[model samples]
Structures are given as C-alpha cells and as structure tokens.
Target chain A: MNVFVVGVGLIGGSFAIDIKAAFNEAKIYGVDRSEDNLEEALSLGLIDYISNLDELDKADVVIIAIPVDATVEILPTILDKIDDNCLVFDAGSTKKKLCSTVEHHDKRRNYLAVHPIAGTEFSGPQAAIANLYRGKTNIICEVEKTAFKLQEKGMEIFSRLGMRIRYMDPSSHDKHIAYVSHLSHISSFMLGKTVIEKEKNERDIFDMAGSGFASTVRLAKSSPAMWAPIFKHNKENIIETLEEYIANLAQFKELIENDDFLAVYREMEDTNHIKTILKGIA
Target chain B: MNVFVVGVGLIGGSFAIDIKAAFNEAKIYGVDRSEDNLEEALSLGLIDYISNLDELDKADVVIIAIPVDATVEILPTILDKIDDNCLVFDAGSTKKKLCSTVEHHDKRRNYLAVHPIAGTEFSGPQAAIANLYRGKTNIICEVEKTAFKLQEKGMEIFSRLGMRIRYMDPSSHDKHIAYVSHLSHISSFMLGKTVIEKEKNERDIFDMAGSGFASTVRLAKSSPAMWAPIFKHNKENIIETLEEYIANLAQFKELIENDDFLAVYREMEDTNHIKTILKGIA
Candidate 1:
C-alpha cells in the first residue's frame, strides 16, 4: 500500500506514523515544499520516501494536511493526479472552502473531507507524535459525497487509529468549528497579547501564573502559519463568534464596574454547565 | 499545635491536609458556616474537629480561606481573638483589601497576608487533595508587618510544604494577579458563555469540541461563590485588565474583517512569546 502524505508536518507526519505502524505493507511517502521538513520527517522515520504530486497516480491513499488556504488552492491538482481507485482525504480545519474548491472535479467521488480534531500547541514534522488521533473525534464533512468503497477504506483506517467519527455538512462543520476550535485560538492569542502588553514585568507574569492561566492561554503558542489561514478561510463565521465573545466580555465588565456581583455570580453559575459539556468532549 | 481552617473548601481543606501531614503534633479544626461542609470534612478526615471563632484562643495558626469579601469582614475579628504568638494568615485571591482592613488592628502583627497561588477548578472538602501546594508559588504580602516570631512559624510550615515564596506588596500582588489569574478566569467564563449562548445544539458542542476548547474553558467550571467575591474585592484591577483584553479582541477582529491577515499572523507570532514565559511557571 502506497500512502502519500502532503505537507509533512504535525498532522500529516503523525498520520504517516500511525498508518505505517498499523499496516505492515504501507510505504509512507512525504510531499512537502520545505526541504527541511522533508529531511526532518525522513530522519524522524515519519516517512519512507520523498514524493511529489506527479507520482500520486501510484498512490493508494493520499492525506492532504496543510493550511486551509493551501488546501483550497492545491486540492484540485491533487485530485487530478490520483487514480480512480485511489482514496484521497484532507485533514484541513475549514472544510467548506476545500469541498467547494473540488466540488466539480471529475474525481470528486475519490475525495473525502476529514478533520481529526487533535493537535498540540506545537507544529512541524519535529512535533509529530504517535497516537495523536486516539480517542479523538474525526469530523467528516460531506462523507456521503465520497465513493462508498473509499469511505469504507477510510473508515477501516480511522477505526485502526482509535478515532470516532462524526458526520456533518461542510457548512455546519465550518460554522461549529468557528465556535469550538477557531474562537479558542483567537481568545487565547488575545489573552496572551493583553497580559504581555499590560504586565510590563515579564518576571511577575512567570512567577505568578497558575495552572488555570497556563491552561487557558496554552493555544496562544499555536503555529501562526497554520492558524492565520484558518482564520482567513472561515472569516465570516469567526467574526460572528468574536462579536458574541466581545459582547459577553463587555457585559461582564459592566457588571463588575456596577458592583452587580449577584448578576456576575449567576452568569458564571450558568456557564458552569460547560463542566458537563467538557466531560463529553474526549 | 492547633491549626484552625476557616471555610473548609478547596484551599483551606488542602492546607488542612498538608498541615496535618507536615506537623505530626498538629490538630486541624474546621470552621465553616455550612454544617454540611463540616460534616463532609469530618468524614473525609480533612479536619479533626468542628470549631469556631470563639475557640480562636487555642489556635497556634489560623488559615482563613473563604471568599475575599468574607475574609475582609472577619479577618480583624480573627486577629482580635488570637493570642499574640498565634500566627494568623488568610489565603484569599486579593491581598490589598484584607491587609488594609486589619492595617491598624491591635493584633495586626499576628496576622500574615498570604495568597498561595494554587488551586484546582473544583471546590469544597471533597476536592481536598494532599501535596496541592508542592512546587507552587506562595505570594507573601507585607511579610514585615507580621511579628518576626509568627513570620518564622509561618515560614517553617511553608517550607515543609515545599512552596517557594515570592514577596510582593499587596497592591502589586492584586494588580499582577488580575492579569495572570483573575483575567484568565473572566476570559474563560466569558468564552464558555459565548459558546453556550451561540451553539443552540449542545450535542454539536459536545461532539465537536476539542481538547483546546476544554483547556481554554476549564476555568468556567470554577466556583462562582468563590470567584464572585474575588471579582468584587479586586474590582479596579480586574476592570482594567478586562478593558485591555476587550480592546485587543476588537482590534484583532477589525484586522480579520479587513483581510489584513499579515497583521493577524504578526499578532499571534508576537504573543507566542508566552511559550517562553510559561516555561518558568510550574
């Protein structure tokens, strides 16, 4: 089995690692614009050979795991090069744009839109680790558009990788992800910016930050190259969520200023329902 | 040694556990307005006996670990009842108000203003766990104001718990804590509120929410009875932090709306400096 992994970085490299481990016959091929990443992935044993789009016809499976913007730009070329029997899937954050980009392609039935909801704050081939998708949800947008045989092939791999599947339309996937995933990165980045700007003494922030602050601001360290594009491709949905978030923060600030602490307490008590929601997450 | 733990919840109950383990001769007495909490503490073995302020004369040390508003109300009364040699400290989030409330008390020298920068999202006696303070920062405000003998006694216990001490003025502690701790809680709570209000389908939030959302929103699960008082006591500092955070969010949204993703990328890249600062935190 020939598996070609484009954009040999965290998500792609992690998938390469798990696929190789699960299937003894799998020969993982790396396709990345960065020579450094390809070399690093090779040395890290995340991939067996350096390959490119021209050789994709021989590929039995291809995983496109790049920035969402790049996925929108290059997904059609990938579909053009793959054989009719080949199963091609993308692990992009925003699915609506990518699905729309390749909607009219002749090989649309060979393509599956996948988003395995897993990542760390770190990125790049060096950040890749085994079993990243274990116990993690894999959101498949427009799964019904893909050929049944390819869907079965993808499901077998997802099952072996220890991931659960959730199906939704491309539009719903983009809208919901803006709230759960994209909005979180924006919130974390802004929290980090606010603290960095206000707390002049770097030493004090370091000395005083508790686990709560650390966990809340953890996503501020995510790769800007990856997230900036996600924010762009899902701009409308993201802007809507940000407006709601800003309004919430403004209202909370007013309650504090007015000494209306009873309202403040009630607000927090209502939001504590997140505890039960979070329990169902992983 | 008789140790009195007021408001036997996460912070106070945790201290009770550590104090009992560290001091072989120590007898921990629970003091709370809630009879149910006292009963739970007794069953959990977090306290040796249910005691009250009237019995303060027997206390070798008193840890007031209730809400900050309540701490301000009762700290002076606690100081008045303790013996001259009894070391009294309060583990509240804000320090300036508590220090000022008992600033000129006759037994002021017996009181030590402490903000041990440690806790979990859970509260109450059932949430108590041993070694909660290990390797965490303990911010001691106005340490010189406490009697030298009592200071030594408090320092001895802090050392036994493996806590590192950082001396900060009460005003400075509250100001910096607003950025690091208090601001994070507000941000998390508001984030949770925004998601819950916008995502009408709770099932989508549950199935699609990733680990990033869970981590960023974890503080939303915090005890409102505890945090509402902290927000009230540290109003000025918290409001300032909230304003700055909201402004940053608005600016980022405008940049996204205008398609200035370069600026968005730069903002996140700059905030990535938090990675280095967080390395210093335990």
Candidate 2:
C-alpha cells in the first residue's frame, strides 16, 4: 500500500512513521509547504517519496494531517485532484466544518472524516512518533457518505495503527469535543498566560513549577497555527464553554475570598468525580 | 525509634508505610479522626500501634499529616505534649500560619515544618503507597528552628525514603507554593466545573474525554477538604494569582471573539516554552 500524507507535522508525520512500522510493505510519501519539515520526515524515513498534488495520481491513500485551518482550506483542492479509488481521510480535531466543506465535492465519497483522539502538547515533523495513535479512539463521522470500499480501507489501516473506531454525527462530535478537548486547550493556554503575567518572571516560574503545574500547563505549549483555527472553527461552543469556565473560576474565587472553607472544599469535592470519569475513558 | 503519625490519610499514611518499609526496627503509631482510616492503616501494616495524646510519651518522633486548618490548630498541643528530644513535623502544604503558630513555643526546637511535593489527587489510607515520595523534593521551612540533632534525624528519614530536602523560610514557601500547587488546584477544579456545566451529561464526558483532558484536569479530583484550607492560609497570594488567571482568560476570550488568529497562535506559541522549563524541573 502507498500513503501520501500532507502537512507532515506531528499528526501526519507521526502517522506516516507508524503506518510504515505497522505494514512493512507500505511506502509513504510526504507533502508539506515547509521544506524543512519535508526533509526531516524523509531523513527520518517517515516517507519514501516527497512530492505535491502532481503525484496524487499514483497515491493509493491521501491523509490531511495538517492543522484544522489548513485542513479545511486545502481539502477541496486535494479532493478535486484525487483519483476515484483514493482512500481520503483527515486527522483534524474538529469534524463538522471539514465534512460540510467537502460534502459537495465530486470525490466526497472517497473521504473518511476522522479524528484520532490522541496527541501530546508537542507539534511539527520532529514531534512525530511510531506509536502516537495506538490504543486511542478514532472518531469517524458521516461514514455513510463514504463508499464502503474506501471506508473499509481506511479502517483497516487505522486498525493496524491500533486505534479504536467510534462513530458520531459531525455536529455532536463538535459539541462534545468542545467540552472535552477544545476547551481544555483554551483553559491551559489561559492558565499559562495568567501565571506568566502574575509572576512577571519566567525564572520564578521555572524554579517553582512542580510536576502538577507542569501537567496542567502542558498544553500551553501547543502550536498556535494548529490551535488558533480550532478555536475559530469551534468559536461559539468554545465561547460558551469559556463563559462557563470563567463563571466557575469566579465562584471559586468568591468562595476563597470569603474564607468560606466549607464552600470551597465542597465545590472542589463535587468536581472530584472528574477522576472517575477521566479514568474510565482512559 | 518510635514515630507517631497523626491524621494518617494519603500523605501521612503513605509516609508511614514507606518509613516502616524502609526501616524494619522503627515503631510506628497511628492517630486519626476516622476509625475506618485507622483500621485500614493497621490492616495495611502502615503502623504498629494505635496511640493518642494520652500515649504521646511513647513516640520519639511525631508527624502531623492532617488538613492545613487542623495542623495550625493542633501543632501547639502536639508540640507541648511531645518529649523534649522528639522531632515533630507537619506534612501540610501551607507553612506561614503553622510556623507562626509555633513561633515562640519553647519546644519549637523540636517541631519542623515540612511540605513534601508528592501526592496524587486521591485521598485516604487506601491511597497510601510504599514509594510516593521517591525522587521528589520536600521543602522544609525554618529548619534553623529545629535543633541540629532532630533536623539531622528528619533528613535521614526523608533521605532514606528517597526524597530530596530543600530548606526555605515559611513565608516564602507559602507564597511560592500558591503559584506552584494551590493555584493549580483552583484552575483545574474550575476547569472541571466548566466542562461539567457545559456537557450537562456525565455520559458525554465519559465518552469524549481523551488523555489530553485527563492529564490537564487531573488536579480537579483532589480532595477539597485538603485544598480549601491551604488556599485559605495562602489567600493573599492565591487571590493575586487568581486575578491574573482571570485576566489571562479574559484576554484569550477577547482574542477568540475578535478572530485575532495571530494573537491566539502567538500566545500558545510563547507559552510552549513551558516544555523546556518542565523538562528542567522534572
């Protein structure tokens, strides 16, 4: 099998590496706007060939693993260029907008709108890995629009990559993902920004941060190029979630100010159930 | 040596278990408000005897591992009851009030204020483990107040437990910890509350939570009884920190509302340096 991956950053680049590891006979091709990322992917042997849309003719499968904004922008052109048999898929964090954007395309049946629910706070071709997607959930939306053969081909590769496939409507995926994944990025970036502003000294932050602080602030390091568009696409839901997040923070702030020990404790105690919820999902 | 560990919940209980496990000859005694916690402690062999203030004469060392409020309220009583040669340490998060409470006590020489930077969000005796403190840093405030002999003893025990002991003033410890640990709990708890409010259904949360959300919100599951008082004691610093946090959220929220993709991306891009900082500390 041959795979042509666009963007060649963390998600695409990592997928390329992992796919080749899973299927030794597979040949991977890398495509990206950045020469450095493409070079790194090739040097790392994440790809056997590097080319642009001109080579889409011979590609067996095409993966759009770029940031959400780029994925939405370039998807239509790629769809127009792909052959009828190409198994097209995307690893975007959001789905509704991308699926809707390409819903009317001639090659729409060739695409599988997918979101593999796994990634670290890191990004770029250098951050790619062989096992980045193993044992994680891969969300597939609007599958019926995809031809049976194409969907099956994508699923077989995803299964080989060790992902658990889940099905959902694009709208539902967007709403739920806003709460679970998108809002977390916003909260983390804000938390990091807040402390950096308050401390006014990076040195102080470096000296004092413990493991808990590091884990909580981890996502603050994610690529702006990738996340900015996610927040933009999921804006309404992100804003609604943000308002709720700020309200919760304000309520806790008031409880702390009043020295309302019981209220503060009970509020935190109430949210402690997140442990069970998180553990169950993992 | 005989060690009396009061309030043997997660922190104290784990400490007791590790201490006993590492040193077979040390006699460990347990005291707690919960009969079940004490029974669990006994059944786990974390301690060798059930003792109290009435039996204070038996312990050559006393470890107060209770809520911050309780530690401030009980330290003087426990200090006055202990033998002159005995070393007493409190494994509480905040140290300002606890240290101040024992400032002029004659036996202040016997009391050491220590905060071990190790724990999970889980609580109680069942959360006790043999090696929670290994390779972690434990902060000891006002070590000069503790007599050289007892300080040496405490260091030996912590060292044998595979912990690194760093010393600082109580006032500084309280302020720095607000940024490093307590503030993290507030941010995470509020994040959990925000997601809960938005989702309005636990099932949605269960199905959608990915590893990113899990690690980011891990601190939200921490025991409120343990955290509220820590915030109460460190209120001023926490308020300043919380205000900065709110302001950061507002700034990010406005950027999202305005579609300032560059600002959104750059903010996260800048904060990503936390990866370098975390790499150094961890």
- Summarize candidate 1's per-residue lDDT along B1-282 as a digit string, tens digits: 999999899999999999999999999999999999999999999999999899999999999999999889998889889887899998999999998988899998999999898999999999999999999999999999999999999999999999999999999999999999999999999999999988756565568888999999999999999999999999999999999999999999999999999999999999999998899575
Off-target runs (Cα >4 Å) in candidate 2 are A200-207, B21-24
Residue B93 in candidate 1 has what lDDT?
A: 93
Which regions in candidate 1 have their CA more than 4 angstroms from the true location? none
Tens digits of per-residue lDDT for model 2, B27-127: 88999988888888899888788778778876788999999898888889998788889999998999989989999998999999998888887899889
lDDT of 2 by residue, A170-274 (tens): 998988899889888887887777666556663643455667888788788888888888988988888888888888888788888888878888888888877
- Scored against the native two-chain complex, candidate 1 gets a DockQ of 0.88
TM-score of chain B of 2: 0.97
Worst 10 residues of 1 chain B by lDDT: B198-207
DockQ for every prediction shown = 0.88, 0.69
Docking class of 2: medium
User: Highest TM-score among the candidates is held by which one?
Assistant: 1
